[model samples]
Target: MNAQSPKTVDDTRLDSVIYQDGIMRISYTLTKTSKDEIDSDAFTKDKKALAASVSCDEKGLGQFVKSGLLIKYTINDSSSAPITDFQIGKSDCL
Candidate 1:
C-alpha cells in the first residue's frame, strides 16, 4: 500500500505502513511541529470526525473499514517520538 512512502501529505509525513493482527498501521511524522505543539484537547475532540471520515469514505478506505480491517494512525513528533495514536474500526464508526 505504501508504494511511495516517506512522502509528505499536507503537514504530516507518512513514515511507514505495516500490517499485523488484521490491522493496517500507518505511521506519520508531523513535519511542521513537535508533539508538544499539538493541543491534546483539540485532537481528542476531532476523533469522531476523523473516524467518520474513514468510515464514510467511498474511495478505498471505506472498503477496508467494511472488511473488518482496523486502521491505525500513529503520529510522531519531528524527533521521531510518538505523540498519539488511534484506531478506526467498524465499531468506532457505528
Candidate 2:
C-alpha cells in the first residue's frame, strides 16, 4: 500500500489555508477582510496577488479563489491532485 502526500496551503496576510489528509482548514486573521467584499470580480482582479500571497499555484489556486470558496469560513479540501487540476494550490516561487 502506498501513502499519499499531505496537502497544505500557507497563511496569507488575512488568513491561513491548509489541506491535510483530505480535510481543508481555513483560519482567519485579525486583519482578515470582510467576506462580503470578496466577490468573483474581486477575486478575479486579485488572482495574481492572492496566488502570490498564499503558498499555492496561481492557476490551481485561482480556480478555488475564483469560485468564492476562499472567502467562506469553512471549506472542503478537494481530492484533486495537488497543483494539477483543481488541487492543492501551491506554486513555485523564485
Candidate 3:
C-alpha cells in the first residue's frame, strides 16, 4: 500500500501511510519548509482541496472514502517533530 511512499508532494515529503483504528494517517515531512514557516490558516484551507480530490477521484482514495474512514494528514518538521495534524472524513467529502 505504501509502495510509493517517501514521495515528495509540493514542498513536503510524504513519509509514510498507516491504517488503524478506522483512520488512515498519511505522514509528511517538510523538506525545504519548516513548522515556523507555515501559515496555519492558509495551510488549513488546503484541506478543501484535499477533500475535493478524494471525493472526485475514482482511482485513488475512492475506495477508502467509501469505507467511511477518517483520513488524516500529519506534518512533521525537518527535525522529525510533529508540526500539525488535519483530519478529513466522509462528511468532509459531502
Per lDDT, the best of the predicted structures is: 1
Put down candidate 3 lDDT per residue, 1-94, tens digits, no spaces: 5887899868779899999988888888888767788776787678557655764366877667766878888878888777778777676665
Q: Compared with the true structure, what per-residue lDDT tens digits does model 2 show for residues 1-94?
A: 0132233336222234555554455433323244443453455445535434563445555445444333323221222112111222223232
Model 3, residue 88: C-alpha shift (Å): 1.2
Superior by TM-score: candidate 1 or candidate 2: 1
* Tens digit of per-residue lDDT, candidate 1, span 1-94: 5887988978889888999988888888888787788786687458546765855487767877877988888878889878778778877655
Task: Tell me each candidate's RMSD, in Å, in order.
Answer: 2.1, 12.1, 2.5
Better of 2 and 3 by TM-score: 3
RMSD of 2: 12.1
- TM-score for all predictions? 0.80, 0.24, 0.75
lDDT against the true structure, per candidate, is 0.78, 0.36, 0.76
As for candidate 1, its clashing pairs are none
Residue 43 CA displacement from its true place in model 3, Å:
0.9
Model 2: clashing residue pairs? 56-89, 56-90, 56-91, 57-89, 57-90, 57-91
Best-to-worst TM-score order: 1, 3, 2
Identify the superior model by lDDT, candidate 1 or candidate 3.
1
